[model samples]
Target: MFSSSVHYWLEFYVGAYHALKRGYSNMDVLVALGTNAAYFYSVYIIVKALTSDTFEGQDLFETSSMLVSFILLGKYLEVVAKGKTSDALSKLTELAPETAVLLTLEKDGSVISEVEISTQLLQRNDFIKIVPGEKVPVDGVVIKGQSHVNESMITGEARPIAKKPGDKVIGGTVNDNGFIIVKATHVGSETALSQIVQLVEAAQLARAPVQRLADKISRFFVPTVVVAAFLTWLGWFIPGQLHLYPQQWIPKAMDSFELALQFGISVLVVACPCALGLATPTAVMVATGKGASLGVLIKGGNALEKAHKIKTIIFDKTGTLTKGKPSVVQTKTFSKIPLLELCDLTASAEANSEHPLSKAIVEYTKKLREQYGSPSDHMMDSKDFEVHPGAGVSANVEGKLVLVGNKRLMQEFEAPMSSEVEEYMSEMEDLARTCVLVAIDRVICGALAVSDPLKPEAGRVISHLSSMGITSIMVTGDNWATAKSIAKQVGISTVFAEIDPVGKAEKTQGLAVAMVGDGVNDSPALAAADVGMAIGAGTDVAIEAADIVLMKSSLVDVITAIDLSRKTLAKIRLNYVWALGYNVLGMPIAAGVLFPFTGIRLPPWLAGACMAASSVSVVCSSLLLQLYKKPLHVEDVPIPAGPGDGGSNLV
Candidate 1:
């Protein structure tokens, strides 16, 4: 019978024994002490009844059962709440299509046949076709046709983007119109969609810096509560026996040693370290999951915790604040060649080049060809093509030497430039435009002005940062005039121009800098900054180096990320305040501080309820972050504004 009885309470027995064996005490040690004291006293009462037959007192079997039951219930509820915090990550895994439609084209470029296959069978260089109202199955570049794809899943951009033959498409976006034939560039896990899901999962599992303090406090809290409970027993029972208190002041029930024991047990049951331990981890989990749903990929908790404290946000001018692709805005001619003919010639020379400016010229020429009929019967391909690094391309079109590039390319061919052409190029540079010189047989024909324009939301994003008191700074390798011109358009006052890759990193030193960039050269600066944010549509090097990645590649997402961080941190602070407040107020009352005055005391069961409620309150408070919405306007209560009645920058 004794062996069977010990088996039912085996966990408590083993826990108490282990605490003594290890010569250390934790929350388990305190729990063992409380339950063992009640259980052993009950056994002694039963022993007296069995031997002497004079025991009429009660055994505290219910006390041990109630303590274990409520604490176990609290732990079970905590695990359930923690699972809900990571729901966003698990939902992302269900987005990709399971199957794809493979396509085989005839030699004449007509569709020969189509086959349905699993997405796992897709490989690089394979062709696939996506119809209207179907999700894309893999990451690839469009080779035929155009469509508007909804990329809300990959990037949080709600608007559908127009995709042409040369545009790249993600794996999970929905195609709205037109049949698109794509040549698979990335398949399976190597796709950008998979990378995003992996990042979200990793971030949710990581620990935040704020959790360190909570963890350190919990290490000492359990043992301290155990000592406090012992002192509470000594304060109440020792005074009652020694006649230290007046007869009128002390309650008749408190005069018994059983009353002192009940008070000590209440203190042990009420002081919960579970709530304190959960204060930071639960908040971080919800914030990271919430960030993933908004297309802001915080790489880990450390980055999310650091984001709210940014004082200066440094922006890379190229792909971050402005469209990285250059577009042909204007073209000037120096000869009798028609404007269309000159454009066709320049486009032909740059057709084989892979530079962004070259692709821009090619795209412009194609758009013009669709609008107006071409002058030539057939477009001849350029031969003997050669690209001079940073200068331009030299090729032969229609057996004539065609040189299309910068001024340095023209100068190498001894192409004489008149003051009229020089003045035109200088004016283009002042407007933040790049001029590409076109020459035929050592003679300068004209210059095509290409400009990488600012994104439409750049001004509003900068204004939002200004309102938040975060200084906006532009860093770029462009010339001073061009950099300042773009910065002025984006509402930025600080400009760091004409700097090399290393110089950009050097500029972020000794400040709480959040560097926003999207290129290979930006990797160093992204790693060196306090918080590095990469554009999702940027290079792999930049994304890997950054701490956070904005998948939408919009400047507006930067504002969203910062606001989310501030709100998340605010939630963490609120949790800490509530948890500490609960312990500070409940511990004293449970220790019988008010029993001497009003004779008000908490029973063990009531203390159990309060302990369980404290943990649930902390979890529920963190769950509120799931409802957080990004403040779109100045009047929407910016998180950096802190909690107050009124403030400026509100409209």
Candidate 2:
């Protein structure tokens, strides 16, 4: 009895004392009550037997000792399982390389010296040399050489991407072949790997809305259980004293009071509030970690809980559904100037413009020069370069004025546009292409038709969402004709065009909406939606406003995020059912509800064992989320055609 008191007092009893002083009780209070009653009662029985020779009772010292042992053992197993649920976060934290090869550069950007140093000491503008099979130490742009990088850990993309000069490399990805020099752009906490780890940690600490029910029940669960146990004892003892049942119904070594004490102890130990407490949190932790591993960075339990209920998703047209990378498809020259000369002049004027269409024209001109065996860099330099928003760019190349823009810029400059040019622009617009009109020396000389292709998985993902009863809507700042054309090709029936940032948010006001976008302009709508998903390649503002980040930037992961949330909620429900069902049925039996019929009764030690098992069972059930797999087979999805393949007419 002394040993049992010491064991229970240090652990369960102490915990119960602190909790009660705070005006509350928990599962520990019930455990302490049950074990203390059995231990002290056994001491009373021993003293009575010693004082009176005719008195007889069976001491319950073993019951109390064994109950504490089983409960403690169950707690140990539960803690171990909970630890396994955060394995993804642990792995992410370990991905950063311990050491890096720092490069010292010359005045002209040539490497002069190299030394190995700890990655923690890295700083912005520091150059690093990465060799084959080594980890990229920080997020940076490649300055020299080329290689293929395996970014599976960071982006969840299994294939190795080819890296050349000017390509950005994320920290913690592996360099597969060749050597490269990278200039650090982001280090320490600013690195992508560190941000991902921080996101996962924050997500695990957040509580799901569904957990409130369990929390409310647990607040009163222990005190209500104590009352039930006392009533159970009264129900058994009073009946026994009245001779309402046969004396033989009692165990051979126990009397009415002793049998009633046994039933009360069973009731106290068998009701498990701990299982109810573990139900939602464990499942949420596992699901968040699983999402991190799959490149879907869920913000927390609230987002995870809400995503499953999304009925409609609003997608920004440019970077969300389309590639966002425009390419020149068709070029027409109307002047006496050759097509090559016109393209060179247009490419030179657009060289300083950052617009996607400008880059497409410049790239197309380079490729054309290459096909003709002319030097790609032979274009004359531009002077007085200017960007006209909603129009285009203006510059001077070789002492001649050059204008490259839409018809608006042409009319603004009083540049003449003939009937043929208007016809060409209409035809291109009908095909969902943006026609860029180029004017040289106040005469319309050429036109370049550029198109941004739809993502290969866009159509299939939309079809899948429709089957799942989720409606897809397209919202864009582009014209109605272009928006509808892109929407039709991607299987979406709804489209909202010429909408600005505020207008995009307004479209999501009356529905359970999830907004997916990738630019600074999309940040407002992203924050206004019920759930915002930002593409990983998007601007930082969009990512900050989003509830989830798709690191792979694949439309398919939109499906994965919703599917995982549905599965997680389902698992939490299952856990609650198991916990409640175990108590509802086990508590009655433990309270001697069956002893009046078949002479069956639950021992205090066995009841304690069942209670411990219930909590452990709930945690183990949640851990099963580690085996989650995305329903879609990414490999079977066909790749979208490139620019050379009929100019990506799908969008």
Candidate 3:
């Protein structure tokens, strides 16, 4: 008895004491109460027999000792299972290499010397060499050499992507072949891998709304069980004293008070509040970690809870549904100026812009110059660069007022668009292309017809969402004709065009909407929707405003996020049912409710085992989320035909 008390004092008695001091009761209080009662009562019985020669009584030391042993064993197993739920997080943290090949660069942009150094010493603008099969040490842009990088661990992309000069590489991804020199752009905590780890850690600490129900029940659960145990003792002892049952039902060596004590001890140990307390958090932890592995970063339990109910998903047109990498497909000159000169002025004005369309224009001009055999490595500098949201950009390039954007920018600057320019824009819009009008010195000079192709999976993903009872809508700042053309290609029935950032949010006002986007204009809508999923490659503003982030930047992950949420919520419900059902049925049996009818009763030691098993079982059930798989398998689905094929390729 002394040894058992010493073993359990800190684990149970002290915890119970602290809980009472804080004005609350927990599972430890029940454990301490039940074990102390059994232990002290057995001591009392032994003392009584020792003092009197004729008196005898049964002792319960074995019951108290075995109960604590079983409870402690259960706790150990529960902790081990909980650890298994975070294996994904552990693997992620292990991806970054400890050492990197740092290269010293000369003034002429040539390598001077190379030395191996710890990755912790890496900083922005430092050049690092990555060889075949070595992990990239930090987020950087490839400055020299070419390779195929395996980004499966970081982006969940199974296929390796080809990398060349100017291509961006994420830290922790492996170089499949060849050697490359990378200039680090982000290091330490600013790296994508570090950000993902921090997000997952925060998510696991967040509590789900459904967990509150479990918490509310647990707060009252322990005290209620104690009362039930006392009533059970009264029910057995008073009835035994009144001869309410057959005297043969009592054990031969035990009297009414001893029998009552046995029933009370059994009741106390059988009702497990620990199971109820563990039901929700264990499941949430496993789900969040599993989500991180799949390149879906759920911000917290609140986002996970809201995602499952998204019946309407609003998709931003340019980057969300299309490839977001626009290329100049056709160019036209409106004035007497040469086409090459027209592109030169436009590219110069757009050089300072970060918009995807501006980059496409700049790229096109560079290629155009190469094709014309006048390849120049520099563009004329621009001054007074201005950005008009949802319109275009303007700047003074080479002493010329250059305005490059859509028709709205021309209208804003009162740049006259002649009949030919209007005709060219209408034709491009009908073909699902954006016409970027270039106005030089208040005179319309030329236009570039840029086309951002629909993502190959966009049509099929939309079709799948429709089959799952979700409605897909398109919202964009583009003209109505271009928006409708793109929507028709992707099988979306509804479209909203010419909407600014605030208007996009207003569009999601009255429905359970999920917004998927990758630009600054999408931030307001992302914050307003029931759930917002930002593309990992998107602007930081959009990512910060989103509830979930699709790190792979693939449209298919939208389906994965929603499907995973539904499955996780279902698992949580099952956990609750199991925990509550165990106590409701176990308490009555422990109280000997079936003893008279079937000659069966739950002994105190067996009741302790059952209580321990209940808590362990709940944690194990949560660990099952580690096996979760994406519902939509990209490999299994056939590639859709060209855009406007009405999703005929969906399998």
**If ranked by TM-score, best first, what sequence of candidates would result?**
2, 3, 1
Model 1, range 587-645, lDDT digits (tens) per residue?
Answer: 89998888777878986667777777777788889889989887763233233221111
Query: Could you give the C-alpha RMSD of every candidate to the true structure, in order shown?
Result: 6.3, 2.8, 3.7
Report the lDDT tens digits of candidate 3 across residue range 187-273. 999999988989988987899898888867867988899999999999999999999987889887688889888999999998857
Instruction: Report how far off residue 627 is in candidate 1 (Å).
Output: 1.1
Candidate 1, residue 156: lDDT: 68
All candidates' lDDT scores?
0.79, 0.87, 0.86
Candidate 1, pairs of clashing residues: none
TM-score, structure 1 vs. true: 0.88
Better of 1 and 3 by TM-score: 3
1-651: candidate 2 lDDT, tens digit per residue: 777647655887788889899998887888788888999999999999999989989999988888877777766666666577556567777888999999999989887999999999999999999999999999999999999999999888889999999889999999999899999999999998988888877888899899988877877777888999999999989999998989999888789999999999999888957688788988988898888889999999999998999999999888888888888888888888999999998999999877777788888999999999999977788999999887889999998899999888999889999999999988877777878899998899989888887788888899899988999998888876677778887888998888888898888786679999999889998999999999998889999999999998999999999999999999999999878877888899999888888888999999988887887888889989999999775675777564521122221
| Residue 547, candidate 3: alpha-carbon lDDT | 93
Q: What lDDT would candidate 1 get against the real structure?
A: 0.79
Model 2 worst lDDT run, 10 consecutive residues = 642-651
- The best candidate by TM-score is 2
